[model samples]
Structures are given as structure tokens and as C-alpha cells.
Target: MAALKTSTTWIKGQEFESEHDGNKINVDGDKKNGHGPKALLLSGLAGCSGIDVVDILHKMKVEFSDFSIDVEADQTEEHPKVFKDIQVTYRLKTATDNLEKVKKAINLSLDKYCGVSAMLKKNSAINYTVEILN
Candidate 1:
């Protein structure tokens, strides 16, 4: 089995530094120094799926520009709050004829390729929308 490891160290109150494969990020629960952990998870989901979609689109010969993803989640009110649902919006400038191809890439990413999406879906309902721009 392939294993990936990361390390997180406490920096100060509500602040921590996490490192993986020589990359590092600061996570702060207070949101004063860095992004909160929950927010980072949402980013991870977007990044994972985005990478897959880009690769799939490239393989399909679909050209696109200004591609971006916006992710939002509704969190439960209870302690140990968790995401109840997530909304992912994909926007890009591409040929109108490529719409179906883009959608297919995104679907394949979320449904089959994105490990982060697979894990997040265990607890949160994930919804996605695609917008094509000129």
C-alpha cells in the first residue's frame, strides 16, 4: 500500500503549522493567522476534483480558459460541527460545443476519480453546477 504522511505542530493558541512532502501551511482555528481546518478540507475537495477534471478535459481535447471552482458548505450547529452539504460551482470560458465534454469531465472526477470527494461524500451531500462563460 502507498502511504502518505503529514505532520502538524502547534504554534500557539488555536494556531498550527502542517507540513506534507516539504510543503507547509498554517492552520488557525481563530482564523487570525491562517485558514481553519474545516475550510481547508473544502479547499482540498475542490483541488482534488479540479485536478482530475483538468486532466480529463485535456485528454478529451477540450480547451478551456479562466477555469475556477467555488466551494461552499453548510455546517451543522451542534458541537463538533460538520458539513451537512456542499455546493461546488465550476466556471470556465470555453467553446459552447465543449459544454458536454466539460460536464463529463467534472462528473468523472467527482464520481470516480477524486479521493477527497469520495471521503467527503461519506458525511456530506455534494452538489455541483457548471457555468460556461464567453
Candidate 2:
């Protein structure tokens, strides 16, 4: 089995510093220092899937540009507020003929390759939309 480790250290107030491998980031609950933990989860999901999509598209020889993802979530009002639903929007500029390939790449990433998405989907409903830009 393979394992990955990370650590978070409290800085002050509601802020913390997190490190993984050689990289580090600041996390704050008040949004004063860095991204909140929940928001980071959304970022992880997007980044994970985005990497998969880019790799798959490249392997398929699908030329694209200006690719970006926007993620939004609806949270419950309970004490342990959690995302009930997540919407991921993928925007890219590609030839009209490659639209199908682009969709397939994104689908593969979200459904098969993105571990973050798999985990998040256990608690939140994940929906996606694709916009092919001119």
C-alpha cells in the first residue's frame, strides 16, 4: 500500500499552516490568512480532476487552450456545515470537432481518475457542465 502524509500546525487565532511533502499553505477559518479547510477541499477536487483531464486530453492529441474550472457548492446550515451539492463548470477553447473528445476526457477524470472527486462525492452530489468557448 502507498501512503501520503501531511501536517497542519496552528499559527494563531483561527489560522494554521499546513505542509505536504515539501509544499506548504496557510489555512484560516476567518479567511484572513489563507483558504479555509472546506474551500480547500473544493480546490483539491478541481485540481485533481483538472490534472486528469489535461493528461487525458494530451494523450488523445486533443489541442486545447484557455482551460479552466469553476467549482461551487451548496452547504447545509447544520453545526458541522457540509457541502450538499457541488457544481463544476469546465470552460475551454477547442475546435468544434474536438468537443466530443473534450467531454470524454472530463468524464473520465470525474468518473474514474479523480480520487478527490470520489471522496467528495461520498458526501456531496457532484454535477458538471462543459462550455466550449469560441
User: Which candidate number would show the highest TM-score if scored against the true structure?
Assistant: 1
Number of the top lDDT candidate: 1
Off by over 4 Å in 1: none
The C-alpha lDDT values of all candidates are 0.95, 0.94
Question: Against the hidden reference, what TM-scores do the models get?
Answer: 0.97, 0.96
Residue clash pairs of candidate 1: none
Candidate 2 residue 32 Cα shift, in angstroms, is 1.2
Residues 34-94 of candidate 1: C-alpha lDDT, one tens digit per residue: 9999999999999999999999999998989999999999999998899999999999999
For model 2, residues 24-129, the per-residue Cα lDDT tens digits are 9999999999999999999999999999999999999999999999999999998789999999999999998998998899889988999999999899999999
lDDT of 1 at 84: 99
